[model samples]
Target: MILQDFIAINEKGIYCLYGDFYLDPKEPVATAVISHAHADHAVSGNRDVYCTEATSAFMQLRYGKNAALTFHILGWQQQINIGGVEVSFLPAGHMLGSAMVLMVYQGVRYLYTGDFKLQPDATCEPIQFCQADVLITESTFADPNTAHPDAGLEIKKLADIDINIMLGAYGLGKSQRLIQLINQHVPDKTILVPHKIWPLNAIYEKFGYQLGNYQIYSRKLMKEQRQFVYIVPPFTFDSYIRATGVKRLFASGWKNLQVNDKDTLYISDHADWNDILKAIEQVSPKEAWTLHGDGNALKQHFDGKLPVKIMN
Candidate 1:
C-alpha cells in the first residue's frame, strides 16, 4: 500500500485516511490522536482524544472543561484499534507524556514523530524507535551544523553565577525539566517556581518523577534569597527585563532567545541534526517524510541514499 494514501497532511494537520482520525489537528475534529499535551499539539474540543495518561491530565489542567469529550488513555507501547488501523504510542523524550504515534495498516507501518529529542532527561521518558515502512518526523533542528550541547553541562553553567538569577522558560515541560536539572546539577542554588508553573510541577510529581527542592515563588522569598534561580513564564520574564539586582537569563535551545552573551544557557528539548539522523537510522524506514521545520537539508543529505519527502 502507498504511504501517502494511508496518512497525508492537509490544511488542518496530518490526517490518517484509513483511521479517519487527525494527528494533532490544527482545529477541533471528530477524532484526534494527540502526540502530547503541548498547546500546539493538543487542542481542546475534539470529540474523542487518544493520548497517554499524563497527556490527558495536562490537557485537562490546561483546558479544564473544554479538554475533550472523551479521552482514551494509552500506556507506552499499548496498541489500540481505530477505524481498522492499529495505533500505539512510544516515548518521544521531548517532555513528559510526549509520544511518537505509530500506525499500522495492512502490514505496512507508518511512524509519526512529534517534537522529540535524544538528549538524556531525568524528568521524562527517553525516545524509543521501531522499524517502519514510512517515517514521518519533525525537523525542528535538522541543520547539519546545529548540535545541542550536553544538557547537564549547560545546567552546570548556573553554578558560576553568585547572585540571584531571573531565568525565563516555558511554563509547561521546559520549566519542570529546568527545575530538575537545576536541582541535580547546581544543588547549592535554590529553585523558585512561579504560580503559573507550580501546578505543572505537581502534575510531574504525580507521575512519580521527583523534582527535588523547589518552592513557589513569592516577593518575600525573592527579597530574602540569594544564589537562587527565579523561574518564570515568558510573559513574566519579559515584564522584568529591566528589573534590578538580579542576573537575567533565558533557558532555551534557540540561539535567538539567548539575548545576552554571557548569560545564555543553551539547553534544548528538541533533537539536533545529529539526533534526527540517529533516529532515522534507528527507524530504518523505506522512505522518510519531514515536517515542522525546513526539510531541504534532510532531502539533500539523503539525495542518493534514501527517498526524503518534505511534507508541507
Candidate 2:
C-alpha cells in the first residue's frame, strides 16, 4: 500500500489513520496536532491538542485562559511515539509558533507543512527542510506568476510617507510582523494600533520579540489628527476609522487587491509557485498532496514529474 493511503483528507481535516491523530483539524476531534495558531488552522474543544510551546500559549490566548483541552507541548525536533507512529515538529517560518509536522509510520516518512514561507522573518523561527517519502503542503500562493519581494524592502515603503497612514492587517500574525518590520525599518515613525491588537502584541513580546514603541489607538488621539502610522484589523477599517482622513495601506501578498485609494504592499507568509516547487524538490518526495487555496497550480506543475493529488 502507498504511504499516501495512511493519511487521508476528511471533512474534519487531514487524518492519520494509523496514528489516530489529526493534523490541524478544522473541527474538534479526539486528538489534534496543530501546526500554528491561525484561526483557520487552530481551533478549540479538542480532547487532546499537540503543538509547540508557543502554539500552546497562542491556543490559550485564542481559546481563552480557561479553555478545556488537554495540551501536549512538542518542541522542535522532539520526537514521540503515538499509536505506533513516530512524530516530530519543525519550524515553518510562517508566524510566531508555526510548525511543520513529520510522521513516520512503518519506516515511511510523511511531512505535513502547515502554512509556511521561505523568506526570513525575525518574528519567528526559520523554515527547516527535511527528507520525506510523501509530502503534503499548502498552496496558498502557488500560482507561477506570484512572487514576493523582500520583507524589509516591502515594509520600507512606509518610510517616506508623511501623513498619518491607516494600515489594515490581520490582527494575529500580520499585525505583529508589521509592527516589528516598521520598528526595524522605520524606527523614527510613531506607530499606533487598535486595542484589539494589544493582547497579541503582548504575547509576541512575551515570546522575546522586540517590537518598537507603539500605543493603543484612542478616539481622542485620532481626534488630534496626528501624523502617525495606525494599524487596525482589516474588517474594522471602514467602521472604526470612518471619519478619520488618513492614507490607507494594505500589507498582503495578493496581487489584485481591490481597495479604494489604498496602496497594497505585496508581503506574504506563504510560498509562491517557485518556492513551493523548490520546497518539494528539497524534500525529494516520491509522492505529493496539495491542500489549501487553489491546488491546481501545484498539481499542474507536478503533473508528470511525480504523482500529485489535490486533497479536498
Candidate 3:
C-alpha cells in the first residue's frame, strides 16, 4: 500500500515519486530507468537514462550518439540510490539487455517487469526472479487462449522444407533470435538478413551472442537456385516474398492472424498466459497490476487469488 502511494502511472510513464525516476517512459523525462532497448519501452530524448550495458549499446545503435543527456549503466543486482531510494536492474529474459526494474524504499521492495518471457532464448540473458511487495507486469499475451509452442519445433519446420524459407520478424530482438535459431536448427542452409538487420547482428556478436554463419542479403544470391533462409523485417517481407518467390513464414505469438496455413510460427518473446500465472505465483505480491496489450484476461483469471488490477 505504501509502495502504491510512491508509484503511479502518469502521461509519460510509471513514475516513482520518491525516487523521481520514470520506468520505461514514453516521453522524455529528467531521469528514465529503461527496461530494454525496444523502441516502445526505451524511447529517445530522455535527459538521463539508466539501463544495463547491453541496453546502453542498443540505445546507441538505435538512437545514435545523442540518445540521452547522460547515461548511467547498471549491472544486474547492482543497486544505486536516487532520491534516497535504492534501485536496481534484473535480467528480464525478453531479449539481450532486457531487465526488470526493482526499487526498495523504506525496506519494502517493488518490482516492475517491463517486458519478459519465461521461455528460453539463446540470444539474451535468462530471466531473474525477485520477490516484491507490489508487482507491475506487462500482459502482452495474457489471455488464457494464448500459448506459445516450442520455438525449436518451428525452426525445425523451416529446416525440413525443400525450398528456400523466408522468415519475417521484428528487427530488434526477434531478428537476432531467428538468426540463432536458424543456425542451430539448420546449420547447413545459408542464413541471410536484409541490410538493416546486419548492424544489429554485429551488436549481438559484440555482446557474445554468436550467431553462427550468416550474411547480408544480395540480389546476386537471390538469382541463384540454391535454397537459402532469408530473414527480413515484416515491412520488407512482402516485397522479398514477391521478388524472390520463396516460402514465407511469419514468426509471432498472435494465433488469429489471417496468414497462410503453414506460413505462421507461434514463437513469441513475451510471456504467455501460463508464464504470466507462474510469474504471479512466484512473486506472490500483495497487489498485482498489468499493463500493455489486453490485460483484462489476467485480471479475470486471477480474480480472487490476488489484488489484480488491469492498468490502462
Candidate 4:
C-alpha cells in the first residue's frame, strides 16, 4: 500500500490528486464515484458514474441521459471492490444521496468525509462513525466558536413569531432539515415549497421521509396564511419571500450574513469541531488529513494526538 499527499484541481477532471489517473480530458474517468448530488461534487460530463441511486437520478435530469457513464448504486453498509480498493459507503448526514466513503486499499483503511453533519438534521439520517486505519475528513465547520445552538429551541422561537416564518436555506441538505423540523413540529398546516425546490422534496420522499402536503408558492395561499411556515432556498427569499408576506430567516454555516429582523441558525452540513474530533477518535486512525473549512484549526485541536496533515 502506498499513499501520497497531493490534491490538485485538474482541468481534465473535476478535482483530483496529481498521481491518480483520470479517464477523459473532456469527460475524464469511465467510472466516477460520487458522494452526493450537490452541483459541486457531481459535475456533468462524466461517463460511467458510481454513486447512490438518489444522485444518479439527479444527474440524469441535470446532465441528460449520457451524463453518467454507468451507475453503481451503493447503499449504506454496502461494500464493493474497485482495483484492490475495498470501498464502503456510509451515511453522511448531508442529504438524500450523501455518503462518506471508507476505503481499504492494501490493508490501510482511508475514510473520506464528503460533507457530513453529526447533529440530527430534521430530514436525514444521523451521521455514522466507523473505525479506519487512516481518516480524511471534511472540516467545513471546524471552528468551536461557530458551533450551532439547539435547533429545537430556535425553531420553536421562530414558529412562535408574530409573522409568517420563511427560512432561507439551500435546496439540498438545509431544506430537508427545515422541512423535517416543520413537519415534526408543525405537521397540522400545509407546507409550501418554491417550485425550484420541489425536485429536492421528491428525492427526500424517495428516502421515505414524510414531509406532508407541500405546494408551490402562490399569492392566493399567502393571502390566506395563518401562522404558516415556508421553507425555501436563499435565492427564493430575495425573489419571492418578500411578496409572500413572510418574515425572512437564514440557516447556514456562514457567519454575519446580512438580514433584517432575521435570526440566523448556525446549522451546518459538515461535522463541528467536537464531532470532527470524536470521529477521528472513534476511528483511532494511524494517520489523519484535513480538508475543507479551517482544517488547520481542526488540526491544532488534534496536536500530538495523531499523525495529521493540515494542508502542507
Candidate 5:
C-alpha cells in the first residue's frame, strides 16, 4: 500500500484509487468527493457527490438540478467506507463548507487538502489538523517571502476612505466575507451586493452565519447613499471598469489583482507560506506532497529533513 497506489493525480483530479472517487475533479465523474462548492472544485454533471451540508446547498444554488444526481451529505469528522477505504472530512478553513479529505488504507493515513487557510474567519469553520503518513496540500502562497498580513487590519483600511467604494470580490465565499468584515470593522459604510450574490448570502445566513446588513444593488440607491460600499462579482466589476466616482478596489491576496497601490485589499482565503509550514508542522506527515502552486521552495526547505514530492 504505497501512497501513490492509494491516491494520485490523474487526468480528472486527485484520484483516490482505494476509494474509487475523485477529489475535486475537473470534469464530471461517477463519484466526486468535493472539498467545497467553488466552481473550479465542484462542477455539474457528476453522477454522485460527497460533501458537507453547506457545500451541497451551495452547489444546488449554483448548479440547480445539474448540481449532481445524488448528494451524500457528510458531517464534519463523520467517517464512511467506500471501496474498502475509510474516508472523512475535516475543516479546511478556506471558506464555508471547505474540507480537507482524509483517507485511510491499510492503517496509513493520507490527507488531501483542497485549498486551505489559517486565518480566523467568523463566516467559516476554522481549520483542524491531524497526523497523517502522507500530507497532500495546496501551496497557493508557498513562497518563503509570502506572508499575509492580518485580515482584520486589512479590512479596516476601508474605513479610511470617505467616498463610495466599488469593492470587487468573488460571489460565493469572498463576497459574504467582505460583507461581514465591513459590518464589523467599517460599520459606518453601508454594504451593497449585486443580485447574483444575494442568494449566496441568504444561503450563508441559512447556515446560521449572520452577515450584518446588506441590500441588493440599485443604481438609484447607490447614488442616494454617500458612504456605502457596493460589492460586485468579478464580471460586474470588470464591466464597470470605466464607471465614474466610486473608488475601485478588488479584495484578493494576489498582488497582480491589486492593479494599483491604493486600490488593494489584501484579504485572501488561501493559506500563506507560513500558514502552509504551520500546517505541515501540525500534520507531522512522514512525507509532504504539494500541489496548486510551486512546490520547489517546500522541496528545498525540507531537503534531507523530510521527503517532499511535487504533484503535477
Candidate 6:
C-alpha cells in the first residue's frame, strides 16, 4: 500500500492533493472535498470542489454563485466511487457540515478526522465509533495531564456573574455553542458577537440555529444592559474588547497557553487524551499509522499495545 500527503502550504494558497485535487498550481484544485466550512479548511478557488450541501451553502456566501455548483454535495455516511478509490463522509462533530473522510481501497480503510470532538454538541450530530484500519486524528489538545471542567458547569459559572461577560472563542462552532449554552442558562440577558462574525452567524442561522438579539458591541448597547453575553474571536481581545470594562473569559483547548488575563476555560472541538486512546483501541488495527500531529506522542501513549507507524 502507498500513502502520501497531497496538501502543502505555499505563498499564494494551499496546494491540495485530495480535497480539491487539481492540476494547475496557479488555480484551485479541480475536485476538492471540504472537511468543513472553516476558512482554514475550506476556501474558494478556481475549480470544481466537492463538499456537503451545508458546506456548499456556506461557501456560496463567501464566493457567491461560483462556489455552489463547483461542489459535489454529499450527505453524511454517503459513499461514492471516485476513480478506483472508495470514499464516505462521517460526522466529525466539529460543527455543522464537518466531516471525516473514510477511504477504502485494496482492503484497507483510512479515516481522516478533521477536528472532531467526542462529546455531543449543539451544532452537529453526536460523534460515533467509526471502524477504520488506519485512523488519523488531530492533536490540538493532546496532552494527557490537561483536564477541563464540565462544560455546563463552567459555562454557568461565567454566566452567573452579574457583569457583562464577553467569551472569547472562534466565530464558527465555538461562538454558536457559547450562545446556546448561555441563552438556555441565563435567559434574561442577550447574546452578542463581534461585527465581523455576523456573517458567520447568518450562516449558522441558515441551518435553523436561532440566535436571538445578538449585536456587535456599542456604547449605547453597553450602557443599557448591565449584564449580557458576547461571543468574539479570541484575537478580538487585543483590540476590540481590551478596553471595555466587561469581564473576559476565554474558551479553547489550549488554556495552558496563558495568552490572556481573562479567566481560562478548556473547551475544545478535538478529542482529549483519553478519547484518543479509546479511539485507537477501538480501531485495533494490526498496523497503525498516525499523522497530522506529533506521531511520537500518540506512539508513546500506545506503547507496547499496538503496531504503530509514523505517517506524514
Query: Which 10 successive residues of model 4 have the least lDDT summed?
Result: 16-25
Q: For residues 66-108, what per-residue lDDT tens digits would candidate 5 score against the true structure? A: 9999999999999999788888999999989999999889899
lDDT of each: 0.91, 0.84, 0.86, 0.68, 0.91, 0.67
lDDT of 4 by residue, 1-312 (tens): 436543333554433343243212234465567877887677776665667777787777667866766777888878887655667788788876788877766576777777887777656767787888777777777787766666665566565566666778888767777777766766665567878778777867877876666678775776675666677776667676446456677776677643554566665666777877778788788877776556777667667977677632
Angstrom error of the Cα, residue 44, model 2: value is 0.9
- Backbone clash pairs for candidate 1 read none
Report how far off residue 256 is in candidate 4 (Å).
Answer: 3.0
Error of 6 at 156 (Å): 0.9
Q: State candidate 1's TM-score.
A: 0.98
lDDT of 3 by residue, 1-312 (tens): 445567778899888999899988989999999999999998889998999999988898888866898999999999999888899998999999999988899988888899999999999999998889888889888888878999988778776777777778899999899889888987878888888888888999998999888888886786685579888787787665465467778888876541577567888999999999899888888888888878788777777978777667
- For model 4, the superposed segments whose C-alpha errors exceed 4 Å read 5-28, 187-190, 240-245, 258-262
lDDT of 6 by residue, 1-312 (tens): 534453344543434444434211233555666777777777667466657777787778777866534667788888886655677788777887788877776676777677777766776666655777767666655668755556666676665668887677887778877776777666777777777778877877877877556667675776677686777676775456455678777777775533465566667777777777776776665556654466677677778976666644
Overlapping backbone residue pairs in candidate 3 total: 0
Ranking by lDDT: 1, 5, 3, 2, 4, 6
Q: What tens-digit string does per-residue lDDT give for candidate 2 at 45-146?
A: 898888988888888887885332689889899999878899999999999889999999888888999999998888889999899988888988888888
Q: Supply the global lDDT for candidate 5.
A: 0.91
RMSD of 5: 1.0
Instruction: Give the Cα-based TM-score of candidate 2 against the true structure.
Output: 0.94
